[model samples]
Target chain A: MKCPQEFVFAANYLADMARSRSLEFFRGEIGAEVKADTSLVTIADRSVETMMRDAIREWFPDHGIVGEEFPVHNPDAEYQWVLDPIDGTYRFAAGHPQFGTLIALARHRKPILGVIDIPAMDERWSGAHGWPTVHIRQGRRSEVRTRSCTAVKDATVFFCSGIMWRNDPMAVWNGMHGVNRLLDGDSYSYGLLSSGFADVIVDSGMKPWDFMPIVPIIEGAGGRVTDWQGMPLTLDSGIEVVALGDPALLDDVLRRVSAA
Target chain B: MKCPQEFVFAANYLADMARSRSLEFFRGEIGAEVKADTSLVTIADRSVETMMRDAIREWFPDHGIVGEEFPVHNPDAEYQWVLDPIDGTYRFAAGHPQFGTLIALARHRKPILGVIDIPAMDERWSGAHGWPTVHIRQGRRSEVRTRSCTAVKDATVFFCSGIMWRNDPMAVWNGMHGVNRLLDGDSYSYGLLSSGFADVIVDSGMKPWDFMPIVPIIEGAGGRVTDWQGMPLTLDSGIEVVALGDPALLDDVLRRVSAA
Candidate 1:
């Protein structure tokens, strides 16, 4: 499906914000701040998210927006913009280049446009439902696809946070095995899967804003994404979901884990 | 606890070679090459390893060396150089800066020195036994420490690869679910933990060269490195291992997962 012009415009604007802010202090280090939740949040995160939100308000008057920072705005709307601001906040704070900015357009409950922009690493990946996912790194853009790894033994499976599994060890463990490798974090793993470097990503304890944008990118790149029970994931699907290179393997993983 | 001049000389020599070769390629975009094992390796990887091996031979005569690109010479030796050439080949080939070159000095199966030279990321972490592990990022060297996050929920655990869990879904599920969080790749995770950003790192698969260098670095930074069973992870230790900020929590996690 073609992404609406507004969505594309918003994504580009957000990408530019992410890139500019990332370059501003990327080589220069910054101190980290501990949030009320006790997790760390860098100043760049607040700055980046705020910039994106302001641009959104000017561009789309009626569109709802959900972001990691600030209050949730119009969560019940049919058309919404989800922003991670800076998905890899900790990495960014530590001066690692794995961090990025994530923006997505959701119509009703499903993601129709997704953009993952890693400024420090100089990579960008975006896609809309029915359109091929695209990966741009170091100034090159190409269509991306998932690797054809039918079994866990041949595939790489990742969970963004160990706590996601700790939060539900039984489900995480029961569902995955034979995976070729495991990675942590979200946008980057999804990007790797989209670009055929990995095969699966599963985790629990995520928000809608965290998982939504990733869906179209993964699915558009020839992958399947769902909850642990093999159900399609909507924005309301909670934080637990699995994205895999092959639908059949995804089912097998879900079946085994759910049964256990 | 100071690094001997000769050792430093060798490390810098290797680092120079690594940086020169890797920097040239890092300037331009490069694609991934699937190794014989179907694992990802890049052209920069081959170039870096070749340069390092050459430097080792030139700088330190009669010192046997082991690297990713070549077989070990005098595996059972008084002094042997162990090298990964590029530790995160997958990340490097994928254009992720989290990858780096790993070099360690082993004398009779015990690591006496270790260094992680991340040229593309512009950082280096190194330590020898009894010396405090120091982080050298962008030409600045600072001593590193592990954060004292005692509570399980308060801690950030690095679960290196979910694929390990997929291999033994039952075991990994039980093991990982007990941790607070899982980060990707033990090498980088251990580096983070050593520098106080993360608290624990657990992994099921590791080679001696992959893990040995990390041990001194972690222990030197006031942390514990052991088999998942809480046993010290000497070269002879099992592949499964855990590094923790606090011994009590480490024990609790190990017991919980082992029981599961």
Candidate 2:
């Protein structure tokens, strides 16, 4: 299934809007409030999401919208735009540059276009169903693909945070012993994987806005993303997410993850 | 105990030399090798250290030099320079921008002047004895200070990695539950601490070159850095290290770390 060119253009435009709005609050004193879930939220997140949502409605009224800061709209529509206006709000609140805006155009619940925009770093990764993953850094665009690492032992893994895994934490920690495990990076980890700088990313407790935008980018880069049980991610998929730059390592990674 | 003006000037010159050389290999392919200690090293690390060492020797012939890649030179000299040309090799090898060059000038074994140069990000933080810490980004220099957060539970902590603690992992892991713990950033984390972006940084298994350069920067910003046992870090200090943006949190942080 080919992704619509218009959707890709819209995603890039939406990301631009998000980058401009979010930069205003970054590094400045933001009025950050603790959400019900204990995660931090700032006015920047709401403002960026609202700006993107309004643009989406004005340009494509029939398109649905799902954002982190607001209620879902047009849930039953064929084309749905998923937005995490500010992913890694914790990093953002801490004045870290790894936070990004995620935008995905899902066609009938399957993502076909995705964008990961790191505003502070001026880096962005965009991919669609039928196109190669493209990384743009400082306005230089180039195609990128995942590197091959068939064995899990030799892989460089990015595990977001150990505490996020509510289930058997020790098992998960021990499973990554032989590998080079970096315990940082949120959505930026996926972009690194797509660019072949990282081999795997294991994270849990993700939302639709978190995981959906990455599926297309990872798949388009010849990588794979799935639930812990090895199922494709959807709007209704479970939160335990595993992404592998080399698709062949899926079974080996899943085996270790299942043991955890 | 004021830092010598000449030493501060020399340290900044060395950092500039490292920045130009390290940026050449960053985000580009280089021959990376695994050391006997299982840490990764590259030509960039060796080259940057060699370049800095040469400049240090030429500028101050009597000064001693200690670096990660090579053996100590003039180890008994009154003035000694400690260097870690590439502080976060894993991130650098993975094309991540958080890696930095650490430089410190110690007088009679006490670090009086220090610099943390992040070449890829074009950011540097420098501090000296009796001087406020200064941060430079894109040629803009500003004096930075640590924000006050005295409580352990309310602090935003940056723990480098979990697996580095060989003695007891679970205890340390559980010790950080109530705080907002971020598991990334190497030397960059310390810079963020000095700039008031983070509250605490806890890590283990650090050598002199790793911990020396961070002391003055943290201390000058009105923060504290010490061994896990609450002792000031010296050339012979233990590898277990902890830093706090607010000095009032030292007792509380050490209590938790000791329990771990």
| DockQ scores for all predicted structures | 0.23, 0.40
Pick by TM-score: which candidate is best? 2
The residue-level lDDT of candidate 1 at B213 comes to 78
Per-model TM values vs. the true structure: 0.75, 0.93
User: Model 2: how large is the Cα RMSD against the reference?
Assistant: 2.9
A1-260 per-residue lDDT for model 1 (tens digits):
46776577668667987789766765343332221122335566777788888888887778888888788777777788888877766565544567778888888877888888888667888888667788887778899876676666655566566334454454555455544434564678778777766666766677777788788888888888888778777767876677886666776667755654
Using lDDT as the measure, which candidate wins? Answer: 2
TM-score of chain B of 2: 0.93
